[model samples]
Target: MANPVLLNNIDHKDLHVQTGRGAMFGDNVMSALTFPSEFRDIQACYPIVFRKADDGNFEAHALFGFQEGENLFLGMHGWEAPYVPLTIERQPFLIGTNGTELMVHVDLENPRISSSDGERVFLPHGGTTEYLERVNSTLLAIHQGLQQSRGFMAALLEYHLLESFAFDIELDDGSQYRLAGFYTINEERLSALAGAVLERLNRAGYLQPIYMVIAAMSNFRTLIERKNRVHAAQC
Candidate 1:
C-alpha cells in the first residue's frame, strides 16, 4: 500500500496554494500548453517568494521554449510568467512546440532579505529550490527516455493520458480541494474542471500508483506523435 495514499481526498497541508506571486508552473506539453490562459495585466503583479537566497550566487532566467506560441519565462522563483517578448512585441512568449523540455539553471546571482523576514536573505535558492530540483530531475528523466529503457513506457502510454479518458476527483473527510488547473482558467470554470477530475478519480478511493498517471501525462502527445508522425530518422 502506498504510504501517502494516492486518492481523491489528498491532504492539502503540503499542496502549495498558488497566490502572492509565488512558485511558477509548467506543463508536460509537446505542442503547446493545452488551453492557455488569457493574462492581460502582466507588467504588473511582480514576483514574490518566501525563500531567502544567500549572496554571491548567480541566477539565470530560463523558460521551457515553444516553437509556435510564446516561450513562458521562468524567473522570479520559477514562476511561469509572460512579458513583452524580447524578439517580438506583437507576439507573446512562444512556448516551443514539441519541447524536448527545458533545464533552467540558477547560479544564485545575489541574495537579499525579503521584507517579511530579515534573517534569511533571498538568494537564487529558496523554498522553491527543493521543488525546482525535483522538477529538473523529472525533466531530465523524460529527456533521457529512461522510461523506455526501463521497459514501462509501452503500457504506461495507454493508461493515464488521452483526453478521451476523463477523471473524477472525490475528496474524503470533507477535505477541500481547490482546483486551479493552469493559471489561465477562470474562477468558475477552473473549479468545475478540477471537481470533475477529482470526482472521476476519487470514485475508487485510491490509485494503485499515481506516478504512472503523471508519467502518462508527460509522455502523452510525444509518444502518440512519435507513433503517428512520419520522420526521416530510422525507427
Candidate 2:
C-alpha cells in the first residue's frame, strides 16, 4: 500500500530519492499507463496496448512483459530500453490538485525514499533542489498527459476503434503463456475511416498516435527476444 502525503519543505527537507530501476523499487510492472503524447518514444521500444480500467473505461499502456510482476526490460544492468515511459519515470511522486493548483505528493513507503543519501528534495537553505524541480515538472506533465488521454480515449470509443485481443507466446523452453483481456486499435476500422473522419482525428492530434500504436505492435517480437535472452541466461 502507498502512504502518500503532500510534500512540504519543512517536513521533507532532508528527504532524498534514490535514482535507479529495479523490481524492489517497484519497476517490475508488466505495463505502464501511458498517454498519446508519449506514443512516439513508447512505440520505439514498447507495444502500446489498451486495457480496461476498474470502471471499464479503456486506457492506453506500454507493455513491458507478458506476466504479472514481470518486466523484461529490467535486468542485472537496469532497464534495457533506450526510452523509459514517463509513467515509470515518475516514481515515489504523484500529482495532487489543491483547488486549481497542482501539488506534488510523495509516497513514504517507497524504497526509493531516503533521508541520509540520494538526491535531496531541498537545498541547505530550504529552497527547492534541482532534483525536486525536475520531479515537479515531470508530475505536471503526467497530470496534463492523463487529462488529454481522456479525450483521446473518448474519441476512440466514439469511433468504435478499440478491439479486444490476446497474445499467445511460446517461449524457447517450450512453455506457453496466454495473455488476454487487453485491447488494441482495429487496423481494418482505422484504414476504412472516411477522409473526413481522418481529417477530424488529425485536427484533434490523435491520428499520429493511433498509427504509432499500430506500429508499436511490431515490438512484440522485440519483447519476445528480450524474454528469450533472459530465459537463456537463466538456463
Candidate 3:
C-alpha cells in the first residue's frame, strides 16, 4: 500500500530520496508501463509490447525480462541498459490532482525515501532541490505522456493494428520459457492500410511511434542474450 501525501517543503523539508538503482528499491520487474513519447529511447534498449490492463484497456509496456519479477536490465552495478524507462525512474513519487491543478505526491512508505542519506528533497533554505525539480519534470512528463497514449491507442484499435504474440525461448541448458499475453503491432495490417489512412495516422503523430514499436522487437535478441548470460552464470 502507498502512503501518498501531497508534498510540501514544510513537513518534508529534511526528506531524502535514494536515487540508486537496485531491487531493494523495487527495480525488479518484468516490464514497466510506457508511452509513445518515450518509445524511441525505449526501443533502443527494450522491447515495447502491449498488454490488456485489468480495466480491459490496452497499455504499452517496455519489456525488461521474460519472467515475472525478473528484470534482466538490472544488475549489481546498476541498470545495464542504455536507457531506463521514465516509469522506472519515477519512483516514490506520483502525480495527483487538486481540482484543476496537478500536484506532486510522495509515497512515504517507498523504499527510496530516506532522512539522513541520498538526494535531499529540499535545500537548506526550504526550497526544492535539483533532484526534486527533475522529479517534478518526470512526473509532469508522465502525466502528459499518459494522456497522449489514450489517443494513440484509440488510433491503433481503429486500424486493427494490434496482434497477440507468443514467444518460445530455449536456453543453452535446454530450459524452455514461453512468454505469452502480449500484443504487438501487426506489420502486415499496417502495410495493408490505404494511403489516406496512413496519412491520417501520420498526421495524428502516431506513425513514428508505430514504427518505433516495430523496431523495438529486435531487442528481443538482446533480452535473450542477457537471459542466457544470467543462466550461464547461475550454472
Identify the leading candidate in terms of lDDT: 3
Which regions of candidate 1 fall more than 4 Å away from where they truly are?
1-69, 75-150, 158-161, 164-235
The superposed Cα distance between candidate 3 and the true structure at residue 114, in angstroms, equals: 0.5
**CA lDDT of every candidate:** 0.25, 0.92, 0.95
Q: Pick the candidate with the highest TM-score.
A: 3
Q: How close is candidate 1 to the true structure, as a TM-score?
A: 0.17
RMSD of 3: 0.7
TM-score of each: 0.17, 0.98, 0.98
Model 2 clash number: 0
Deviation from native of the Cα of residue 185 in model 1, angstroms: 19
Q: What is the per-residue lDDT of model 3 for residues 1-235, given as tens digits with 9 covering 90 to 100?
A: 7899999989999999999998999999999999999999999999999999999999999999998999998887999987989988989899999898999999999999999889999998998898999999999999999999999999999999999999999998999999999999999999999999999999989999999999999999999999999999999
Worst 10 residues of 3 by lDDT: 73-82
Clashes of each: 38, 0, 0
Please estimate how well model 1 matches the true structure, expressed as its whole-model Cα lDDT: 0.25
